[model samples]
Target: MKSKLFDYVERDNLVFHLSGVTKLICFICLTFSVMFSYDIRVILSVMILSLIFFKVSGLEWKQIKLMVIYVIVFLLINFVLTFIFSPQYGVEIYGTKHEIYRFNSRYTITLEQLLYQITKLTKYASVVPLGLIFLLTTNPSELAASMNRIGLNYKAAYALSLTLRYFPDLIRNYQDISLAQQSRGLDLSKKEKLGVRIKNIMNICVPLIFSTLDRIELISNAMDLRGFGKHKKRTWYASKRLKRQDYIAILIAVFVLVGSICISVFINRSRFYNPFI
Candidate 1:
């Protein structure tokens, strides 16, 4: 199938047929589970499971490569800053410190710190894939319809749909505008100095922003002509009811969430599992 402006949601696969609302619901449960629990084992399992699901969905790594790279860089930055500022944060949280190295009066490395940071990274690793899976495997129109099905106002649902559709379009428009700028003698190539390349991009960004605004106005006018949001409720031509697979998926997600909460509260006696104790 041809890629749309909403290319993330335009893919075809077994997961593509699942109800959008079900994916959102299950994703929420899984995300919450990962976020609330600090167990390394649980976090690792969730991360592995999410990657397996992503593989099963038949999405190409090439399609999501840039986004994954951005996430990884952000996470790495967080990791470095955590060590720079709060070197003892994990020790404090875990209530135990086995010092691996003492750098100075204020800076020391500990095994507890390593484990804490790993768990933190694992939390991010698990959640990012779940979010990517939802965005890439579900249809945007169906997602909007699912929002409306679950009691969100039609206006809000429509707005959400437009936002989802707008991002990919914006990127496409940026590329087109950059090419036009290049034709007009702007040099944005890597051969240019960093400062010059930035200036070239700024030149491209100005017209791209204007173009985006014009397209937004056009969409608004078209919707106005069609009498969008004239009714409190709207029908969705593409929406599907929850299916057996969707139910099973949702149940599994909920079970994971509840199980994490129970283990954290009852077994671990806290969100953090202190092996050092």
Candidate 2:
């Protein structure tokens, strides 16, 4: 039997029972908190607490390891480019510079620069687990319903749901196509040189694109046949009413946001926490 698309969300968990709207709001609040704050304490708090929630949600690190690695790599590249273009950005932000290494006149690394990059990395890291949780734990239909309930246009919300649901199907199609190509003796294995494997992977893209387009056409046709957009309003079978826990979760998220603002306004007197002082 083929497994269902949202079977992953059926498991029991601390966060699974919350309304989709609650989770969405919480994720937004938490993300904003991380985005606007530069306090090491606040960043570390959000990151550590998010990891705890990830575990409480019954999500495993192994499941998201590849995505985590990719994000880290991107952050590293961004940090490198930041130093390349504006190596003294951190000194300007923090108003202090403790030289670490003298590569050249314009290329000397400073503690301020290193710390600023670390802060940027930490902010990105803090939000990733929350993003993963929202993605992996929320049912597509329920997310659409939540969005619609929160005043988004039903058309757009439903479109978002369809996009999310299509991803796994796309992955399956890719895997099937890869297997077919492999059987025909196109090796995409580690035994081949890296460049050759990359070229072999690019060959998979053509078939994958055509297949995806075909699937989309079929889906659009089916929706049209069913008169999907004939009505202005629709109800979702997967939607649920908010419970006490859902309200509590929103409150907690609100607290994080409010606390973040407070820290910036009163404690830091700036968006950044000055470790130098």
TM-score, candidate 2, is 0.93
Residue range 118-166, candidate 1, lDDT tens digits = 8998899889889888887877788899888888887888798888878
Best by lDDT: 2
lDDT of 2 by residue, 2-109 (tens): 323323446687788888999999999999999989887888998998888888888766557668879989988998998999898899999998998998989989
Of candidate 1, the 10-residue stretch with the lowest lDDT total is: 1-10
Off by over 4 Å in 2: 1-7, 193-195
Q: Scored by Cα lDDT, where does model 1 land? A: 0.85
Cα-based TM-score, every candidate: 0.95, 0.93
Off by over 4 Å in 1: 1-6, 9-12
The alpha-carbon lDDT assigned to residue 88 of candidate 1 equals 94
Residue 5 Cα positional deviation in candidate 1, in Å, after optimal superposition: 9.1
TM-score of candidate 1 on Cα atoms, chains taken together: 0.95
Q: What residue pairs clash in candidate 1, if any at all?
A: none
